[model samples]
Target chain A: MVERHEVRLSGSGGQGMLLAGIILAEAAILADKNAVQSQSYGPEARGGASRSEVVISNTDIDYPKVTQPEIFMALTQEAYNKYHHDLGPNALLVVDESLSLTDDLPEKSRVVRVPIIESATETLKRPIVANIVALGVLVGASSIVEHEFIEKAVLNRVPRGTEELNRRALDLGFQLAAGAVGGNK
Target chain B: MSPTVKLLQGNEACVEGALAAGVKFFAGYPITPSTEIAELLAERLPLVGGRFMQMEDEIASMAAVIGASLTGTKAMTATSGPGFSLKQENLGFAIFTEIPCVVVNVMRGGPSTGLPTSPAQGDVMQARWGTHGDHPVIAVYPASVPEAYELTIKAFNLSEKYRTPVIMLMDEVVGHMREKVELPDVPQIPIEERPRPTVSKENYLPYDNNQGDVPPLANFGDGYHFHVTGLTHDQTGFPTSAPAKAKVLYERLHRKIENNLDDILMWETKDMEDAEIGVLAYGSTARSAARAVSLAREQGIKAGLMRPITIWPFPEKLITQYASQLKSLVVAEMNLGQYVNEVERAAQGQVPIKRVLQANGELIRPDTILQAIMEVK
Candidate 1:
């Protein structure tokens, strides 16, 4: 298990990346690990740069903000361009399939591309669950927290009537990640 | 037995703390970093049979808090930098009249309307002297989410005990950060209510110091027809321009906090047994300083941390004691230089002081503080 893991999730405002970060941190806490989640965004309610960072550890967490993320997920090309440079060595970089990876990206870092938004919109028929789908993809790709804990946290956080939709979106995300990584884990 | 733990944002924990401390009324205007405190209270206060009011603006919100407290309700208001500035005049009013209330200033970058979403420690002096006059202020700052919960309760407790406005000085980082908090049972948390008059209604004096520095406060309409005013008042609570009466009132206002420093001052010292260098920090910056201290210890530097949970009343005695022992001190803060001046004053040139300052909206990283620690070492 990764003793301490830092995760960064970035997208435009209204994308619910902040909520996704909260759910991820909640999942870590449910697994009995220490976790902290923090976010930064422009004044705009939507369509501006939005980023959320979570740090999970088995020990006490100090310096709550993420400095270097070992696991990074960016849903938009703009976000990926803005934040992908600060990945830790041997970091796991997860991005939407629509974004292209640059050649100068960190050599030791592993990149996983999945159709997160597509899975939520096309498979689940709900664009709002894209954040949930992203959570699944990131967690499924990194195995940061146990899958059951993430599922529980997702159910606990999402709207009351949309549990089934979010559950499906999460499953689709895991499937997408599994397919992208050659079904290894 | 396993503790009941939950993932809570700092602002949410603050609301819980306020409720746990028996706060029954919230009056606030929505502002970033602090809006969540008001928002969560708006939802939860009514469920607990409490009152939540979003007044026309910050000034009115502060006034409303004073009004609620006058009626024997534990009241609070939350705001950011600009709003904190707007509430200062009334904050002074609350201070002068000795009204018990909590004002939460989630500090953001500012001289005026500055970075609304970014963190800063610029309000250190403001929390103490923002409200005009020579009144004593109690401002408690929390470095973590749990401390946020604990200190919010303490803020209310101190306010009620002192019959003064206590400032819960939170910054953007601690206000927005989410962490795992093992919440204690409601009945287990210590709650402090304002001291009520034991005397009969006809004999009650609002600002009477004969009983003690903090006289028992009688709630409005509690059969006690006592006057409270911003103007300097005597024991009878009437407006007085008499020099001797005003002097006694002002002296007592400061003496209440000064004499009770042992109770009001809260701080934490880590690894100071044989340390030659010390780091003094508060709020979120202290979190980084703690990590930096650990790292410095690993590198064979005898570094220690002194985190002041109670920002105002300044923790001078502790700083003086530590300064006498340490070779040098490093003060880390989100603002360029605010609390460092206080540290220098407290240290009194006994030791050299280094400041790890940042006001560009980003948190002061551990490495930056570590570098300062190295310099001091």
Candidate 2:
């Protein structure tokens, strides 16, 4: 429970990153921490780059937007390429296996390569649940929010009939991250 | 469904606040950054036995709200920049006719659809004088989601008490940003209704300037026949070309708000007890100013914040009080220089003023304001 923690979820337009950011904020609220979520997207309804930032703090948050993220999740290569440069000290960089970093690293932060999409599509048997899996990895890797709080948030937000599927997807995220290098940062 | 805490966007908060204040009718055409207000109201209004209408255009939407308000229904309309421009004539009509209604402008980058999805505070001046002629206006701006919820209720209450159209001037940042909010119980919050006629129908005058500045408005179907028009009228609501009557009636319209400045003004000040530099801001810019003030204080600089929860009838007297004490003032907004004009007029050359302005649809950052604070003496 640091004084303030900034988390960003970045991916393509249809990746549901905004909802992931929202769930994270709600989880922080469940933990009795103040949280604010802000997002931006391109004009196109799909395939365009989208990013959502969640700032969780013990005190009131004045500047809602994230200037430097302590935890950054890049669900797509373009997202990784755009946001990888700006990292807080010893930041945790979570990227899906489909994207590779061709650029130099900042040396201060740690990187976790997880198969977020592959877990959702092949293992969970539902690609649309990828965002929930990504959320699980975010919690496991950074411990920014609790798993139980996130589970409650997911159940509160997900569609009515797919609660069990999203819950399993979240568990799969934690399992995938448990085996990841430097998972428990 | 009780009054529990929930995560809501600023637009959703506006609807919640309006409903809490007893808003029964919403007439609005969907527009970007503000469509959520209409959407949420459409769903919630019907459930609460209220009516929601998606009007043909912004003009028709404004007219519809006024029409509903005349029938004693608490009504509101939400729009954005171009739509706000379209709403001005009828907004003026509401002002002169002394109809009470809430008009929300979730401002986007503007002039003409400047930026649909981006944030801007370009509507500050437009909210004050968008409609033509000399009339009274009370526009309130909220810096965050909770204030958006609270001030919308206040907007409705003010419109009812003063018998004028109240504007909830919001920006895209506040409108679109999501945050957790704890709403109060509906029964716990106070609600105001438009004052009904105290005298008999024979003695009732819709524009009765003789009794007091704000005459009691009898609802259209409340067994009282009264004429309400956009044109200047006297005791009875009829077109009048008489100079003496026009002068008295027009002055009362202005005097009603101008005379009640203390009752209408709402502002927030922080760390102003012993600060040499003051930051004056409203809307989303105030959030950044709050951060910059704390950051400057950490660096041992004397900086404080003055935020206006109510923007129009611009908090000039309070600004003047701070202007005399502070060495300089910094006005930050998303627009180039909309509200700065009033800040300067209130400062009256008593203190030097600096501006941190942006119109590129990006928010004015905290570090930018902190740098301005460091630059000034």
Candidate 3:
């Protein structure tokens, strides 16, 4: 039996952080891999720190708690500051540049800053899509989920008629994360 | 073969389990930690043509289930700490009145609204004592989503089989986390339903002795002239305060579960072959303790785990059997020494029983059990 990989997503309450986690876990489940998704949220719906964790495995995961995160994503200053310390040297850390991060980076940890918020508002015209954009970056770095599978899962989760906007958000993230956003080549 | 085992939260599996059990009636209020139970049930129960209602309060929700149960339907209700407390009086009514129903308590951290959304195994004692009196009850503590699904079906079967209430006890962790659960074909599962009365109204005795410990119940106003009362009663079902009659009724009520102890008690044991120390636990905490015992063994320590799948009726017999082999027993629970005390008493001084307890609005993890296991010396 293959081991399961753990992923943790962190952001402010209203940033659709939890939705991002759901989409990724759904992708794994859709891919026929053993997956578990769980969240820890505060009482406040907005402006509060909200977080979600997903476990992708080849075998059954005995416990849902994530003591070690193989991949971590933080979308806000508070989220980054709170979870950045928990990142081990081998962990992948994804950050949203719109939210400033002053925390000293973990030694040898891969830190990728995607303009998730700016792209969500300017390109997608919806700040809520910031999570989707970050999910693209997540899929790019982790290679744990097929990009098409994650897109389809997001479409299934979002409200009908908003699929076009969500799809565009996905395209933006995919392009940016693949180093195709600004003709970086 | 089981479906691709994608992880699902315990609450979600329960919704599917209830559907598989052929449960057709659900009425409940949303309580933190347990809300997912209602949420999932609400979504699925309707698809199966079952009735799911969010009542005004927990009291009415409990009452609604009894009313539904009277209609010859498999009725169920789910709640958390305070809601469980509120449903006690009517639950007593259920026991006295012999209403076979299922109640799921996804326990959260609590004394009273202690922690709204956090997990804790603190309600093991509550499930037993929430309703007053010496009446019989069934409590199934599931450690995983699959067990949640299978035991939920068992809860309904036992409730209908013995004509009493069955409690599906879930704590924060099991209630929320998703795990892969394999569902069996519904027809393959053994389902128990209440025996309907065949006697004519004029000759009917609701509490007839011929029915044995389990009396056949006739729906109210079904032309069966049988008396039902909360007060102490005789076999005629009429309220009687007579000492002899009350004693017989009380003994019969308790005997249904106690006398049939072997059939009612369900427990799981692991690594007990040559163990020096055993960890006794139930509910979600039991799940972690099982793994920790394996870890202890890997480190060259002899540790075993005894889990009470049936939390009530205490499973005092099994605990008594392992009395001699136990070097030091540690009881780890989500609450403060509830089931721990039962182990201590069952140990009977042949061996010492220690307690490793936590009710800090969080789940008891494996490391916590390992720590307690190391302290067992």
| Over 4 Å off, model 1 | A182-185, B1-4
lDDT of 1 by residue, B104-208 (tens): 999998988788888998988889889887878999999999988899899999999999999999998998899998777763557888788889888989887
Give the clashing pairs for model 2: none
lDDT of 3 at B54: 95
In DockQ, how does model 1 score against the reference complex? 0.83
Candidate achieving higher DockQ, 1 or 2: 1
- lDDT of each model, Cα atoms only? 0.89, 0.89, 0.82
- Best lDDT among the predictions, by candidate number: 2
**What TM-score does candidate 1 get on C-alpha atoms?**
0.96
DockQ numbers for every candidate? 0.83, 0.79, 0.41
Choose the strongest candidate by DockQ: 1
iRMSD, per candidate, in listed order = 0.9, 0.9, 2.3
Query: Which of the predicted structures, 1 or 3, would earn the higher TM-score when compared with the native?
Result: 1
Best-to-worst order by TM-score is 2, 1, 3
**Which candidate number has the best TM-score?**
2
